[model samples]
Target: MKTKAVRMYGTDDLRLEEFELPQIKEDEILVKIMSDSICMSTYKLVKQGKKHKRAPQNMDTNPVIVGHECSGLIVEVGNKWKDHFRPGQKFSLQPALNYMGKLDSPGYSYEFCGGACTYCIMPNEVMELGCLLDYTGESFFEASLGEPMSCIIGGFHANYHTNKRNYDHAMGTKTDGNILIMGGCGPMGLGAVSYGLQFENKPKRIVVTDISDERIARAKEVISEETALERGIQLLYVNTAKMKDPISELMAITGGHGYDDVFVYVPVKEVAEMGDKLLAFDGCMNFFAGPSDSQFQAEINLYNCHYTSTHIMGTTGGNTDDLVEANQLSAKGAIEAAVMVTHIGGIDSIAEATKNLPSIPGGKKLTYTQFDMPLTAIGDFEELGKTDPLFQKLSESCKAHKGLWNGEAEKILFHHFGINPKEL
Candidate 1:
């Protein structure tokens, strides 16, 4: 089969090319990618090229497709797993397959098994590791979002609090405790906030901090304080840029008791240090951001670590269990995955979008693999609608959902673009 994909040749080298895909082996399955959410990890991979642990060398000759957080329909099932998976079934996968302790993974090391293409082959290791998941969600975008959400859930699960009695360590965040999300208004941060609010052991209070007023405002509008109140959780969004003393002001919100769990969403040294100061007694600070710099350093309070049990940890990709939990939570409507999406485009836009993802101001940049369109933000639809009727209809659909992307807008996009989902 021939597939069109954005392949990475080297550092800052990406090409939109059409190539023939090798026939799938009996242990491999073919998937027609429907939607893929661009991630910053892809940008890092592009910048590092072969230096990235998951990325392969010799990319000039053997390039790998970009994009990992993706969802689609099963086009052809290999005979080896025909009983477990069938054609036309919705699917998503945990990209961080630590199979046999190998660092290789789809979207980084695979030539034909990445999410950026119209169709890609799933190797046997994916199914063997049980990373291939059956998605029951109504929309493919939500399924695409499940991967990132799984990362957020994994961070929450990685947090640990210590018990003084037996010197035991407790897994997961402290239940019904004060939680602080530092730099929590961006795409992944918003997902963290939404998941924290809807999690089974929901925190009693959530304090979100961001330097950008615009992001804080948009986040509040999406997951309003009223909605959080209905769930019996106290939610607060603070623009640290406006505060005279951010530490004092944030501490006041927790009644000077400090936070039980603090998540640092930014990789900046200052943000990490700020999170360190905000931790309560036995507080667990999770550095959730992935920094591009290998020399990135942040100073922590070792005094508190030795005296008060304050600790810090960091996690990267989520495991299979976290991905399954993310799928279940999203399917049940407990978490609004749409909150992370702000822009949508087609497979043609992947190279540019993934290359400049950090500069783009918004949440997730969703791409429809079969379509050919420029990257457009949901908020810009109303303005772009003046000259284009397609944007006009999409603007109406998004406005109906409070300036957010939805499945209805997705269908409208496909229909207007003359790409039929049924045919894919």
Candidate 2:
């Protein structure tokens, strides 16, 4: 079968090309991709290409597809796996497969499998590890968002605090405690906030800090302050760039007690250091951002680590369990995955969209594999509606959902784009 994908040949080298897909073996599966959400880590991979650890070493000889966060329909299931999986089932993937202690993952190591492609083949290992999960979500975008949401959930699980005796330590964020999310208006940060608020061990207060007021405003709109209030949670948004002393302002918000849990979303040394300084007694700081450079370092106070039990830690992609939790929460409406999306486009625009992801001033950029359209920000739907009737319908759908992308908007877009679910 013929398929199209955005392949990465080298650093800053991405191409949209057509190729033939090999027939699926008895142990393999074929999927037709629907929705894919762009991640910052993917941007880093685009810039690093062959130098990336998970990236194939001989990209000049064998280029690889570029995307990890995606969802699709099972077009053809292997005969050997007929009992476990079937055609027409919707599914999402957990791409962090630590197979044989090797860093082989989809979108980085796999040539035939990646989220950016119209169709991809799932190898035996992916099925053996249970990395592919059946999704019952309302929209493909929700399933695509499961991967990024799992990363945030993993960060929360990695956090822990030790007692004075050091005999016992509590794992995970403190319940009913002060929590601060640095750079909390970005795509990943917004997911962290939604998880933090809706998590079973809910916090007493959540303080979200960002440099852009526009982003902060969008965060509030997505995860409504009224919802937080109804849940007895105090939600505060602040632009640290406008503050004389950002740390002091954050400290004052906690009434000088500092934050019990600090999540640093920016990978810069300065932001990590700032997160460390804001830690309260027995506070745990989770460096949620992944840096591109290996030698990246952040300074921390040793005295605080020893005397106050304030420590910092970091985690990479999540495991299979985290992926399942993310999928379940999103499917149940316990968490809103749509809030992370701020832009939408089609597969044809992925090449240019990825090259300029850092410059794009919004949250996650979603791409539809079957559609051929220019990249459009969600905020500009109304403006674009002036000329296009489809965009006009999309704008009305999104506005009805309070400016956030949801399943309703997805259905509208799919119908207008001529994607018949029954046919798929």
Q: Summing lDDT over every window of 10 consecutive residues in candidate 2, give the lowest-scoring window.
A: 415-424
Clashing pairs in 2: none
lDDT by residue for model 1 over 318-373, one digit each (tens)? 98898899989888888888999999899999999988988998889999998788
Q: Give the per-residue Cα lDDT of candidate 1 at 59.
A: 83
Error of 1 at 303 (Å): 0.8
- What is the Cα-based lDDT of residue 387 in candidate 1? 97
- Provide backbone clash counts, one per model: 0, 0
What overall lDDT, based on C-alpha atoms, would model 2 receive against the true structure?
0.89
TM-score of each: 0.98, 0.97
* Residue range 195-275, candidate 2, lDDT tens digits: 988887788999998999788888888897788989889999899899999889889999999999999898889888999
What is candidate 1's CA lDDT for residue 401? 90
- Which candidate number would show the highest lDDT if scored against the true structure? 1
Q: After superposition, how far is residue 329 of candidate 1 from its true place, in Å?
A: 1.8
* Model 2 ranges with Cα > 4 A deviation: none
Q: Please give the TM-score that candidate 2 achieves against the real structure.
A: 0.97
